[model samples]
Target: MRRVAVIGTGVIGASWAAHFLAHGLDVVASDPAPGAEARLRADVAAIWPTLAPIDGASPDRLTFTADAAEAVADADFVQENGPEREEVKDALFAVLDTAARPEVVLASSSSGLLPSVIARGCPEHPERVVIGHPFNPPHLIPLVEVVPGEKTAEKTVETAMAFYAGVGKRPIRLRQELPGHVANRLQAALWQEAYSLVERGVATVADIDTAITHGPGLRWAVLGPFLTQHLSGGPGGIAHVLEHLGPPTEAWWRDLGQVTLTRELVETLVAGVDEELAGIDRAELVAHRDAVLTALLAAKARTELP
Candidate 1:
C-alpha cells in the first residue's frame, strides 16, 4: 500500500507512522490531543535518523489531520492505536468502518484486547477489522501479531499479513484468539516467576534484571527458548531433552512460585525499581537500549541464526 491512515498519535501510533514513512509510504495521521501534531512530527524526526540508513526515510510524506475520518478517507490501509478501552474502541471502529473503503483492512494496535470485542460495533464490515498488535517501539521491533476475530474474513487476514510482511515486519498469524496473544503471555509467565522471586526475597530487582540482561536475554535475542533448549541437548537435540529432562522440567514447573500483586508486593516492586534506577535518567537509558538494539539487529542480520 502506498498510503495509510494512523488514528491516535500516541507512542505506538507515532512509531507505526515512522515505520511506514521509513518504508516510503505516505502517512495521514490524526490525534485530537493538543500539540499532538508537533509531538508526532518530532517523534518521526527523532526516529528517522535511526531508520534513514535502513530505508531512506523522509518526513516530507507525513500529513497530520484533526479528524480521524479525514485521515482514513481514501487511504489504502488504516491502523488504529487508540486507548485500550472496549467501549472507546467499539465507538471508534464504527466510525472507521464507515469512513474507510470496504476493502481497506482496519487493524488495531491493541496490546491484548480481542478484535472480536473491539469491532463489535462495526455491523456493516466487522470482517475487515483485525488485530495488528506490534511490540513496543515499532520502528525497531519486527514482530507484529496479526490476529483475526471470528467475523474477520480469511482474505482480510491474508491481506493484513501480506501488508505487514511487505513493510519489513515479522508477522505471525495466531490460530486462536487469546488474551495477550503469544509474546505477551510468555512475558507475563516469566514476570510472574520474577515477581515471585522478588516477593520471596530470592533476588533483588536489580539482580533479576542483571540475570536476564546478561544471561538468558542475550541468547534469547538470537534464538528462542525451544531452539536454545534443543541446542543445549549436546548432540541429542530436543527429542533427547524432552525424553530425559522433561520430567525434571515438569517438576520445576510444578514447584515454580505463584504470586498476587497485593499492596505490599506492589510497593516492594516499585521501591526495588526505584532503587535500581536511582541515578539513571529514563531517556538516556532508552537511548542506550535502542542503540544497543540497533547494533544487535545489524549484527544478527549478518549471521545465520534462524
Candidate 2:
C-alpha cells in the first residue's frame, strides 16, 4: 500500500508506523491521548535507526493527526491499534469501518481479543475487518497472526496476509480463533512452569531467565521446539524422538505445573524481577535485546538449517 492509516498511535501503533515507513509508505497516524503525536514521533525516530540499515528507511513520510477519521479517510489500508478493551475496540472499529473506504482492509493489532467481537459493531461491512496481531515491538519482530472472523471475507484475509508480507513480516494464517492465539498460549504454558519453579523455590527469576536466554532461547531463535527435538533424535529425527521418548514426554506433560497467581506468588514474582533488574536501566536492556535479536536474525538468514 502506498498510503497507510495507523489508528491509535501507542507503542504498537507507532512501531507499525515505523515499519510501514521503513517500507517507503507514507503513514498517517492518529491518537487522542495528550502529547501522543510527540511520543509517536519520538518512538518512530528511536526505531528508525534499526529499521534504516535493513531497508534504507527514513521518517520523512510520517504524519500525525488528532482525528482518526481524517487519518483513515483516504488511506489504502488501516491498522488499528486501539486499547484491548472490547467496548473500546467495538466503538473504534465502527468509526473506522464507517470512515475507511468500503474496499480498504482494516486490521486490528489486538493481542488476544477476537476479531469477530471487534467487528461486531460494523455489521454493514464486517467482511473487511480482521485481526492482524503482532508480537511486541512490531517494528523489530516479524510474526503477525492473521486471523479472520467468521464473517470476514476470504479476500480480506488474503489482502491482509499480502500486505503484511509485503511489509517484510512473517504472517501466519490462523484458521480458527482461540483466546491468546498461538504464541501467547505457548508463552502462557511455559510461564506456568516458570512461575511454579519460582514458587517452589527451585530457581530464582534470574536463573530462569538465564536458563532460557542462554540455553534453549538461543536454539529457539533459529529452530522451533519440534525441530530441536528432531535434531536431538540423531539419525532418526522426530519419529525416533517420539518413538523413544513419547511416553516419558507424555508423563512429563501430565506432571507439568499449574499455577494460580495468588497474592504471595505475585509478590514473589515482583520481588524477583525487581532484584533481577536492580541497578539496570530498562531502556538499556531493551536496546541490548534488539541488538542481539538483529544479529541473530542476520546470522540465521545466512545459514540454512533443516
Per-residue lDDT of model 1, residues 1-306, tens digit only: 899999998999999999999898999999989999999999988888777433545789899998988899879999999999998898888889899999999999999999899879788899999999999899899999999999999999999999999998899999999999899999999999999999999999999999999999988988989888889888999999999999999999998999999999999999999899998988888788789988988888899555
Once superposed on the true structure, which residue ranges of model 2 sit more than 4 Å away at CA? 53-57, 304-306
Compared with the true structure, what per-residue lDDT tens digits does model 2 show for residues 1-306? Answer: 799999998889998999999898999999999999999999988998887533445687888899988999999999999999999987888888889999999999999998888889686799999999998889889999999988999999999999999988999999898888889999999999999999999999999999999999888877889899889999999999999999999999998888999999999999999999997888998899889878877787689565
Runs with alpha carbons beyond 4 Å of true place in candidate 1: 53-56
Residue pairs with colliding backbones in model 2 are none
> Cα lDDT of model 2 overall?
0.90
Ten-residue stretch with the least lDDT total in model 2: 49-58
Give the top-scoring candidate (lDDT). Answer: 1
